[model samples]
Target: MEKTSGWRGTREIWIEAAYQALIESGIDAVKVMPLAERLGLSRTSFYGHFSDRDDLLKALVTLWQSKNTGNLIRQTEAYAETITEALLNVFDLWLLPDLFDSRLEFAVRNWAHTDQDLARMLEDADQVRVEALQAMFFRFGYDPDYARVRADTVYLTQIGYISMIKDRPSEPPGPRLQRMPFYVEVFSGRPVSDAEWARFRARHPVAS
Candidate 1:
């Protein structure tokens, strides 16, 4: 393990730099020496934050899970009174950048193609996210097998969306957001009221 002396700064600075590098270039560009140079500090400062490059990579995965999967699960539990509401709450992950990062997710997913360890980590994270979504469905009275399928459907759809959209998500939210209620109906085997639809539109207010 590497050691450092008197490095006084938050680990976020390094992680942010790594995140940028990962997004801009690829995982190989997220090196301690390069990051240290970018930050105008010695590589020793990295040891203050992470033990090595593998540690930094692990941190990046953790950050992605915490910000994307964790945030979506929190929103699902927080906003969903009904199955329709639950689906829209989860849809926010694709519709809004504030709730998740499509580019970063794409970057990590692409990286995973080359690294078995990263692939495993991502697979595990996927399971956790699906389970969390399943819990949300179960709370609304779905059976375990039914909820599991619904949860996988929602999670995989979002992942597919991220995979397809290569550029910064410039797609207008209005048209797509309009279809969310329909998607909810399909996924949950439930109907959405006009009032519920109106309320959802009011909350999002996507332009046509």
Candidate 2:
């Protein structure tokens, strides 16, 4: 175990250790003693930050809410000239790990299967995300009902893709990314112009 010399770590350190544990080995592995060990801190140090394991778990959920759901909504609201660009903005979450943590998302969703409260929160998050997408489409002058359906299609398809690939090794960006323009076209019923594609591609040079 790597040890930190003379370091008792901070609240964020403990929470981040807990977060990694939760994502890597599920909630069952996010215990104070183990986290302290992982951080090279004493078990007592964890209590200085969190009251108990439950408190740490709550903090983890809050982190997820802020990082994943919050960023998704923000992406939908990001400035874009055309609906295709708007959809591409949201797609940034999938391509950019900093924008959205898919592993953390998958971990929390699996954890939710056994926790009723978390399951409800996950449902609320899904609704909030879909509504954000709907609003994005609406801003581009799509009819309300059609916007909702398109939003559902966009959100559900991404969720399904996440679920399907959760356990697989990360693939090269080129294969999947090549399909994104087609996906944007399908989602927004608009073709991506060369300029728009170039802008999006520049943001993700790995796909070039």
TM-score of each: 0.83, 0.95
| The best candidate in terms of lDDT | 2
Compare the candidates by TM-score and give the number of the best one: 2
**Candidate 2 regions off by >4 Å?**
1-6
Score candidate 1 by lDDT. Answer: 0.83
- How do the residues 78-141 of candidate 1 rate in per-residue lDDT, one tens digit apiece? 7667888777777767767778888899999999999998899889888888998999999999
Cα misplacement distance, residue 204 of candidate 2 (Å): 0.6
- 10 residues in a row with least lDDT, candidate 1: 1-10
Give the TM-score comparing model 1 with the true structure, all chains together. Answer: 0.83
Candidate 2 local lDDT, 100-165, one digit each (tens): 988899899999998999999999999999999999999999999999999999999988878867
